[model samples]
Target: MARVLSLVAAAGAATLAAAANPHAAMGGYQPATNVIEHSQIVYDIEAIQTALSADDFTEAKNIYMNGKYSCKSTSNMRNLQGFVKQATYDAKLNGTAFVDAFVDGDGPSYGPIPGSGGRLMLSPTFWDDFLLGALDGTGDFLGMSTAIRKVAINKGVLGVSTLYAAYEMESAIGKKYDDNSADASGAPHAWDEGWAFLYGSHPADDGKYSAWEFSKKRDLDFAYNSSAQAVEGATVATDMLLKYFLHGLRASRSGGVLADMVAARNNIYRMLALSSIRAALKYAEKAQNPYNEEYHMEAYVYFLVAANWVEQAYAGAGTNVLALLDFKKTEAQLSSNLYCAVKTELVPSYQPLGLDCAKVGVLKGHDDTLDDNCNAPACPATQTLPTGLDSYVPDVTTTVGS
Candidate 1:
């Protein structure tokens, strides 16, 4: 298992390195689950540790050809679409100035995410949506995920890396957000930042913000924050990349459906995390400032509702199954989490979109009591209206004290 895992990771690293040239020779090739596996990616890591190792142009070109096929999966394309579109959106609105705002001032929003034909983009939503689609079944998140992972992994191994290199004198620093900046202009956040941004920490826990505004970025931490979120769009991404690196190696040698399934789940869960965070952030944004502990607690319900949908998708990732096909324990988990803070005071009406909060839970008003299970018969905001189709919760600002 260890050897197989190593191979999968190495293949992706190698593929990332070999992406520059269109033609490259691979030593051993076996069709693994409809995707071409690369042995050289793992095995040849020692021979080539730096980009300079590919001394000859011919050496560089050979492995590059195989890298293209790695990211050509349909699953990867949607990722390309989500990420590219989001990046275009980000760039259009924020410009490249904030592109690499995650790690330091020089960071970007996402990663060297591969698009069609191995073109890389640094958009966080690319992988976020790919992971979400894996659970929902409306899209081919699996194929695109594998393709991108494989190529990126392979390139890293060959030392002629595609992603880690510099572009426009920038090393492509990823963007991270301070606890604030969950959204801009009070727009709902659609990725994982919402999760940590909203429910991840209590407002009083940290003192970095002027007001508890989601539009502002957080510069500190309180609870389970990740480098991905810490850097702007930096949280939860490396985990996916690392999972892909590990899974590719396992699938390479073991050649089992389980490894591939894990790889698939990694992508899905990774995105689900992002989606949940985005929703929570949006909810917090709408909740506005001067929010008390009750405000955050109530806001948490919408975020968890979003989480429930995301978890449904992540839980089913092990099988190439549709997450929304049926509600299961994970949804219950979401409900339970919601109960902790949200159901107590849900306002009413709900919406379901990519991480919509309504379907999960809602706050009626200040009477939401965690001490009492969400069995509040007269509770106005709380309802488990069957999980099918998507709708928006009515604007409960007046009722919920928004």
Candidate 2:
């Protein structure tokens, strides 16, 4: 027990240290000045959101299907458009009724988010399918706002952008580069594309409406309050993620070895998984409160996203994580106990990714009394990696990106 506590303390210290000097990557890093051509996709997504707010489905559909954004040309964004178009169509037909169900009787509001705009939570299927289902009248409208803002825009657009970034990273790995121009062919262009998808038109410091905002939201969600021990915990995960991207780009530009690029890509993947886990934990806490359907859906969407990455991080434990984050569970079935189990299950998955599980802090604004059963023995203070994962290596290292 003493040794476990010490390990947890050390992990916290390491996370704080990384948080304090996130740019400690070899050679100082700067945001790339190249134009992120596809970044307008994020803007397009916001426009669609605004259109939906005004019950302007035709306008939303036009922006989604006919927008002049460069990202629309990308295969990934194009793939997402079909889904977004369907959602927008359903919204055009049913959104007014859905909005009427809300106490506010208006479209989703952006003011309540951690940052300035809507929350950009991601999911490949759970939220995606649910959003479509809700809009099509198969699912309840109780959480329809969450379905639109989080799933349709965030998952369908920004999340797909991040996935594209991941694709670019894979493309850049083990490849030779001639120059670092954004227009350059091969690895250089791929690296820039990765950066654009994640950072998108806005500077990193003031990033919005893209994967950057999602990362920031997770950072704020998991951040511990200021203390003598750590002043920068709030942005630790976000900073680390940015640092990884910058480092990876530098390696691509300078013709560095596959190992460096691989390290950066893996770290980015780790942070993605960590951020998803943090989000899941946060909404799980919120879901424990009675009478908030949105919170329940939020918890489920993030947990589903986290599960996808967790499966990648630890192949052997994939089934267990998926079971814990089951998409079939209804709002009433989501509980603190289930999330507590999730937290415990995920603890082991963090170590191999170089993340400190202990730093997955509890989100503020929740009543602790509500989650009393999740503490201590029920959830356990320490959990070991599932029996085989400690020895099982992830396939991500060996899979070549196309």
lDDT against the true structure, per candidate, is 0.25, 0.47
The RMSD of every model to the true structure, in order and in angstroms, is: 23.3, 15.2
What is candidate 2's lDDT per residue for 1-402, written digit by digit as tens? Answer: 010122223323443322232111111222233223444455666676677667665666566555545543345343335432335334431222111111112222311101111112222233345444533435534444534343433344554455556656655652433233332455555665566666655332335677767767776655754342333323356667766766676556543555566566666766776777777667655655464555555555554443445554444333454455444556565544655765666665555544554555556554566446654323224323211111111111111111
- Where does the lowest 10-residue lDDT sum fall in candidate 1? 393-402
What are the models' TM-scores?
0.22, 0.63
| Cand. 2 TM to true fold | 0.63
Model 2: how far is 253 from its true place, Å? 2.4
User: Residue 322 of model 2: what lDDT?
Assistant: 44
* Cα displacement (Å) at residue 225, model 1: 7.5
Model 1 regions lying over 4 Å from their true place: 1-237, 252-260, 263-271, 278-286, 290-402
